[model samples]
Target: LLGRVDDVMLVSGHNISTTEVESALVSHPAVAEAAVVGAADQTTGQAIVAFVILRGTATESEDLVADLRNHVGATLGPIAKPKRIMAVAELPKTR
Candidate 1:
């Protein structure tokens, strides 16, 4: 009820909230902020994709990405894990 219907993603026939995924990503120590979206996937119907801003003290690396994915899988379920995670300097904003 907090977010709009558009914020909900039909991933593998399961309704997953973007906010829920974002929260899970942000819970990681290295993550400062996160945004999640569902992308077209032939296999799953929709795949979770994430863009993350790292904490000032955190460095971006392949290992860190793997750790973040593992963290989300552990926090939520494996189905909630992001298919891809990209480190971004900033997220686009709108008024």
Candidate 2:
């Protein structure tokens, strides 16, 4: 995504910082870890989505999602807010 940034987003517009998303997800108390992806979106043109693994006893909640969204917005501004966030048991790994 560094060299082929333009090839990454097949949709219109670009304002999100992929690196920042990576950082923000890790910053969440509920998120033990995360991986960020670019999802095709009609509205944002290219929506950022986060697939996260939460810490022990931390379940996915609407409040967590909203808080994370707001955190990202406050730190990186609205452009960096993810369109969707999915809390998975674990992120798919590359063997």
The estimated TM-scores of all candidates read 0.92, 0.80
Superposed model 2: Cα runs more than 4 Å off: 1-12
What are the per-residue Cα lDDT tens digits for candidate 1 across 1-95? 26686798888888888998999999998999999999999999999999999998788898999999999999888889899999999998768
Clashes by residue pair, model 2: none
The residue-by-residue lDDT of candidate 2 on 9-42, one tens digit each, is 4224655656677688788777788888787787
Overall local distance difference test of candidate 2: 0.76
> How accurate locally, in lDDT, is each candidate?
0.92, 0.76
